[model samples]
Target chain A: MHIDAIQTPAVLIDMDRAEANLAMAQDLANDLGLGLRPHVKTHKLPGLARRQVALGAVGVTCQKLGEAEAMADGGLADIFLPYNILGAAKLDRLAALHGRVRLSVTADSAETVAGYAARFGPEAPLTVLVECDTGMGRCGVQSPEAALSLARQIDAAEGLHFGGLMTYPPLGHGPETNDWLTRAKALLEDAGLASEVISTGGTPDLLRAGQIPVATEYRPGTYVYSDRMQVAWGHGTLQDCAMTVLATVVSRPTPDRAVLDAGSKALAADTCGAPGFGHLPAYPDAVVTGLSEEHGVVDLSACTRKPEIGERLRIVPNHACVVSNLFDRVHLMRGDEVEEIAQVTSRGALT
Target chain B: MHIDAIQTPAVLIDMDRAEANLAMAQDLANDLGLGLRPHVKTHKLPGLARRQVALGAVGVTCQKLGEAEAMADGGLADIFLPYNILGAAKLDRLAALHGRVRLSVTADSAETVAGYAARFGPEAPLTVLVECDTGMGRCGVQSPEAALSLARQIDAAEGLHFGGLMTYPPLGHGPETNDWLTRAKALLEDAGLASEVISTGGTPDLLRAGQIPVATEYRPGTYVYSDRMQVAWGHGTLQDCAMTVLATVVSRPTPDRAVLDAGSKALAADTCGAPGFGHLPAYPDAVVTGLSEEHGVVDLSACTRKPEIGERLRIVPNHACVVSNLFDRVHLMRGDEVEEIAQVTSRGALT
Candidate 1:
């Protein structure tokens, strides 16, 4: 089937662009002498994870245990979950998954480490990384002393092995994050703990991963399918975006406004600090001013030429990761032809 | 299984509260002498649509053709889709669905009427309502004259019947919307065209449906599962909210901050013009400050108590409809016990 034959409000992945993006990121990581562990949250396709692994990615990064399970079922060998996994249900799943593949997870608090310690045994220990808050302030230990304290807890736990340090640093704060990690590494070394794998990630500062000299692995999720946010942050151009929402101009309600079949459900509601919900590559001047659930209201007042009703258009959404999760399957396009329709193996694996 | 056994980041539908909300809305429409056609976009569960129909709903309203198809497949006899049916693919699907169920759609332009006229035939004439703008500034005919003009076009079409007028009016403008529909109905009467079904909808102003005396049918989507937005609009209270996102407190990175396992992928990014992304009924003073793809950050500075790690909490999202679209299945809870795990059949039916 051709790309045009597919229904509107469908997700289209340009395989050519996606392959090029994957190759570029891999090349950058190889040149910097770092392990590239691509986060699978962007595409959530095991086939793409395999492609990254084929291109020499160390493993894959997953945000949720369900996502990690899906990747493992798809034959992904090494998986790293940089999240604080809690509760008995998820811990049981984690232990079950641990028997199948090489699994490692992160913890920022002693309570999370205790849960892991109680779940696993020394027979096949789980690798636990200490998540440091290197200025991101979302999750992770507050200071180097706290990082050392958590590392010591993991080291002492019978069923857990202290893997290393991990941090999701803020964009453009490489030097500061580097200094913070340096302090944490020094503190860990002083306590007779080896910080073997220092991991840091964020697509905006992915190419500059080497700035943080203590980092051994770089985890970048959005680089697999760079979005409007990546483009806006100067990480790439619009041409580099691999995913685009195929939509139709359903209604031209007014002279200045045209509505598309896609809305927040299709393009998603994550804005890249931009003026519109998405970027229409064909009509760059057109701004998607508003979005209801199923109607993307495009402001065509600024454009000299506007789309008519029934005309199909492709939109590069604000965030690619969230958009991937919104759909069940995505069309892999080779130019205008449909190469394949791949299921998003972990589309709604929120747990 | 009990409600506590369900995993975190799960959508929980309180069936007790939902049945009460459905009954209240149906009773309101009955008292007002209006046909209650509840929109199924909130739950997107055919079972709920059946429940609404059992409680005296005239039919069900759907935003997309796929949703109407899902409802129809689940034995919903009457389905009203208040959206423009465009393109060859959708028109074909719409025609196929129309053959199985009583399907009516709305159109604002002659172009849409032409599409319906091309596909539908006199044997199974489709009902096409003229969608009026009525100050909403979304998809609709601009003026009452435009509504009449479109209605005349539908009446003139060989394969379509002029149903009436439909408007998704702005909230708190009941009298103005009533006057606009009154003029349009009068114009249709002057042209010897009877306005059979004057349909108007919006949950925010649903209780004021009687204020628009010209409306013969009232469509309320979110009232089935009232949300933070509904409560914020003074439509209902937090107790009336039937759906809540069950999440786990995964991290407490600071003294005044905590993080949940649910984020945009689970709870969604929509806000009710309120400060937080959601409302925690158990902790009314806590505010959801921010959300990443997999983490909902909470600001607990104003609260006297804070949630500990590994704790479970139920959050009422800002918008119920979008939250329904985010999950694949929802847990039906009768107070503290789990009733059933219902599938969100049309969760991502954007097309």
Candidate 2:
């Protein structure tokens, strides 16, 4: 099938561009001598996860247990969930998943660690990594001492093994993140805790993974489908973006305005500190000014040529990860030909 | 099932509140002597749409044909899709849907009218409303004259009927919108084109529907499930909100910081000119500072009390309509008791 054969307001993944992106990220990890565990949250497809594993990835990282379960169901053996798992329901699910595959999780607080310790037994231990707040300040232990405390707590738990550390560092703060992780690793080492896996992630600073020498693994989610956000941060160019929203011009209401069928529902409401909602590669000067639920209003005044009614245009969204989560399936295209239509297996896995 | 038994990061629709919201809107429309056409884009549930119809709503409004198709499959007889339907694939779907239900659509351009004219036949004529731009400036004919011109074009078409005029008017511009629609209706009358239905819609100015006396039908999507946006626009109070995201406090990294499992994927990244992504009734002063894919970072310094790890929080999202589209299933609740878990049939019906 050709690209035009598909419906409007659809997510199209350029297969060639996606494969090249995967290969480039894998080569970077190999050159940096770091284990590459691509986060499946970007694609949320089992086939894409398998492709990453086949490309020499150590494992796959899932932000939610539902996503991890989806990956495991797709035959992914080694999976790491770098999230604080709480509550009896999720813990029960975690125990079941651990029984199926090699599982690892992270914790920033003792409350989360206690829940994990209660679920698993020493006979079947679960690797628990202490999440360190290097500089992101989202979800992690406050300081190096706090990281040591969590490591000690994980070591003391009967069913838990103290796996090194994990951090989703702030963008462009490579040196600061590296320093923080180094000090935390040294503190853990001084306390006789061997840091086995120091996993760090951020797509913007993915190429600078070598700066964090202490990080044994690099997990980059958006690098597989670089978006306008990655391009804005100088990670890659528009050509590197594999995913684009295929939308049709439903109404050219004004001479300067053209509305597409894609809106916040299709493109998402995420802004990467950019000027507009999305970038139209065909009309680079045209700005997607605003988005309703099902209408993307484009300001075509800046362009020399404006799209007419019924014209199809592909839009590069600001964020790739969130956009993937919005759709149920994606059309994988090889240039202009449709390769496959894959279900986003973990699309609404928000448990 | 009890609300406590359910997992966190879930969409909970308070059935009592939802029913009350539905009744209030219907009563208001009845009192104002206008045909109520509730937009199902808010709830996206067939059962809820049925409730709206049972409460004397003339029909349900949909923004996309996919939504109308889902509603039709769910046994909804009347649906008004106020969007420009283009392309052969969509027109084919629209024609099929028209065969099943009482369908009416809007078009702003002759190109769209031509597409409809090619598909439909006079034996089963399709109702095509001239979409007028009443200052919203999104997808509609610019002037009242343009609306009449489009109406004349629809009248001339072999398979289409110029049923009426439709406008998604600009918020808080009731007088200007009324003037635009009134002039357009007069133009249609002067041209011997009878506008059977003068439809106008906006959740913020729904109460002022009576102000547009020329409008025979009123469509309001968000009034069925009032959100923070509606509250910000002074449409309803926080207590009037029906849909909320039940999220868990997964990490309380600092005394002033609390991270939730519900982020953009669960709560959405839409802001209604408000300060934060959501409003936590439990902690009114707390602000949701930022959101990652699965992490909602909350700043709790302003609150007198803070949420601990594993504590569940019911958050009213910024926009209810988009939030409902994010989840696959919603737990309908009646004061802490789970009533039912219904599938959002049109959750990803973006086409």
RMSD of 1: 1.0
lDDT of each: 0.91, 0.92
Instruction: List residue ranges in candidate 1 displaced over 4 A.
Output: none
Candidate 2 pairs with clashing backbones: none
State TM-scores per candidate: 0.99, 0.99
Worst 10 residues of 1 chain B by lDDT: B342-351
Q: Report how far residue A298 has shifted in candidate 2, in Å.
A: 0.4
Model 1 clashing-pair count: 0
Scored by Cα lDDT, where does model 1 land? 0.91
lDDT of 1 by residue, A103-135 (tens): 999999989999999999999999999999898
Query: What lDDT tens digits, residue by residue, belong to model 1 across residues B178-256?
Result: 9999999998899999999999999999988889999999999999889999989989899999999999999999999
